[model samples]
Target: MGNSEATLRVDNVTKRFGDFTAVEGLSFDVRAGRVFGFLGPNGAGKTTTIRMIVGITAPDEGKIELFGERMSPKMQDRIGYLPEERGLYKKMKIVDQLRYFAALKDVPQSVADKRIDKWLERMNLAEWKNKKTTDLSKGMQQKIQFISTVLHDPDLLILDEPFSGLDPVNVEFMIDVMSEFKSQDKTIIFSTHLMETAERLCNDILLINKSKKVISGSLREVKASYGKNLIALRAVGGEAMLGDRSLVAKATEHSDEIEIELAENADPQALLKKLIESGANISKFEKVEPSLNDIFIDQIGGVK
Candidate 1:
């Protein structure tokens, strides 16, 4: 899949509303069959960017290409978009809503019905198929929304905050669905504030801040690029040892561990030696990899 053409490409895209720029000079390529995470803080232009991708709005500058062609109405049926906001006709029956959505995408009623049955059953909403959408719990409603999104089996799925309002079990079910999509070679652009979820599902990520791209790369390379600057230490009295100006820049203490950020030029071995010398019962000392959450905060300049 390394040589597969990008499923979607945003080239030098920018969006301006009046005097404010929502997205500025953005560029990235999402490869086929890989789960891509689109992330940014609120008002950082993630929603605007998504709108442009879905053809809800046009970019003020540059261009977006999908399926190796310029983005257009004809290309939209190949993409399934689930917006961050929930919108359902509360008066509509659950199954009727699915049929209507499928019809909008040009799916025949018979085919839509079969696909709806399959998805509703898969989502454990088979029993609620005849119920009004307003009658279901928030979690059940979310499942219904999910069913509507995939009713036509679009090649690329854009999920914005897909796991919101789901219980733990439902969250797992959603994750499994995303993984299943991957197995079917369906590409996804997943957006969520759940850093751990993004880390688990996204093969690549594009992070934006202040309407600009901060970083974009494979997940492994992104984490590796941050380097092993964090240390996880478990020693009975070694918290005090983290105060050495030359070795430790900052330390966040947990009940049974200390997460130490190494000062520039500090050696992990030197920090361990100091902990031993301080008479602490050293149990563990190791270089820690920065997580997606860590990188997100660091890149956005939100870290203290």
Candidate 2:
């Protein structure tokens, strides 16, 4: 048997379309009871990889195992997948649509009914239960789709861009629900380009670029590997400091602060001294860790 603690494993997987390679020699393990982030920019093979994971498409090479077994049709009921595309029945009542989806997963009416009512109330959709899905706002529709995905109480939940249309409030709501799922030991794979959300929510992350794995590990480990050479500085009249190539390699100015990337072998103390000598009023200057967004830029050659 495969490692019992592993919820999902992708081993040397590769997928191609015609002459283009979508995912190349990818390998990773998602442990049980953790939120795993699958991160990449647009057209970075994120969706294609997700498709292979849920068995919507077969890998051109290598293997994928879920719950220590090869992915098969029988496992569908145990997996809740929220695709990037929205596919709710436009005319169906929200509650009825949820019931229909739960039934497809082999959940009996008695259980589905109870779960549907509970989830709708929990998601604040109880008041809109009888409304047609097409009549709900984008955020509301997204929540309904999310409810349909998890109402069956699946063991593994795969969410692709789950926060795509959500407002800040709904985004937090989704995060809270995912946390609840983790507390229940339900494994989740969250795929998105929003590094900020992934940075905050995921226990482990796999960052891909150009169809290849760029980094993979616990968020702490991955950030630590990048080293702390970045400095966040907030000061007045430091525009000239940005051009000092000896003290700074690259500087990106923000509305209220500047992100300074130190050149290799440059000393932070010397940079600070130079700023002081330049008569710049420094408010915030600290050796801070790089955010996932910064790491993504560095890894992918500054591609947005």
Candidate 3:
């Protein structure tokens, strides 16, 4: 049985393409009015799982439920999906394309026109309304695609790699738009390889690797599970001390500071004493909480 509050549920779902397993025993719930992130590295079954959730493809085993019921065509009117692959008609005008998609969702022509105009203006695409979609820049087209997804005002929105091909400014714009949707009590599920974005945007996340789940929980719980084993140091002359394996199991150097993974059972106090004795000028040295990126690298065996 699905949780009454869950907008979508995947129960031990698995998908196989010939002999290769695309997803394995995956189970998670997207609760209503929450921003849920589906995170994974490339080929980590993110897209495959998304396809199954939207009913574009069926899972070989297990069950999927939307709105406390088995997934079916009736749910199509309630879902707005933006695939990773861009699919706008190149030659079609932006307004017409959006209108066509809205109509497909059973929105009336009059209503679609009003919503299209409002969305176009909000997305800063008002001037390009009559222009061919192919003529817009990639970022502009991305905004148009996003507008199309929400034009029908569906209860749930599933976006795959929505930030791809967008500049930083446009990415922020999309983030703001998502925040607005959440404030309006809409449910959202988005898949991304960008851990930073996911960390900032999602209320809950499921991190997968090589077709299997590595972690799934609220962001705070997942990060807290790793404990404070990471040390962030910003120093003028103590970077060389990071090479001492007695203190650090692994060290990653940045332009301004270095992050070190402490050796097992190594006391942080003792490590700080050693760095001081090494004639280093340390500006910042503290046991900092691990970031989602750090946790991901640790769990996945490396950075994506």
For candidate 3, what is the TM-score?
0.81
What's the C-alpha lDDT at position 207 in model 2?
90
lDDT by residue (175-199, candidate 1, tens digit) is: 8998898888888999989899999
lDDT of 1 at 3: 31
TM-scores of all predicted structures? 0.85, 0.81, 0.81
For model 1, the run of ten residues with the poorest summed lDDT = 295-304
Runs in model 2 with CA error above 4 Å?
1-4, 230-285, 302-304
Query: Model 2, 1-304: lDDT tens per residue?
Result: 2323889899999999999999999999998889999998888899888888888899999999989899787788899999999688999998789889999999999999999889889988789999997789988889889989998898899999999988998899899999999988889999988889999999999999889998999999999888758899999875787788887999988888888999888999999998888899999998888899999889888544
The true-versus-predicted C-alpha distance at residue 137 of model 1, in Å, is 1.4
Our tally of clashes for model 2 stands at: 0
Ranked by TM-score from best down, the candidates are 1, 2, 3
**Clash-forming residue pairs, model 1:** none
Clashing pairs in 3: none
lDDT of each: 0.89, 0.89, 0.87
Total clashes in model 3, counting residue pairs 3 or more apart in sequence or in different chains = 0
What value does the lDDT take at residue 209 in candidate 1?
Answer: 87
Compared with the true structure, what per-residue lDDT tens digits does model 3 show for residues 1-304?
2223888889999999999999999999888778998887888999899888888899999999998899887788889899998778999998899989998889999999999989888888899999998799988988998988988898889999999999998899899989988887788998887888988999988999998888998888888787758888887766667777887899888898888889988888987888888888889997887788888888888634
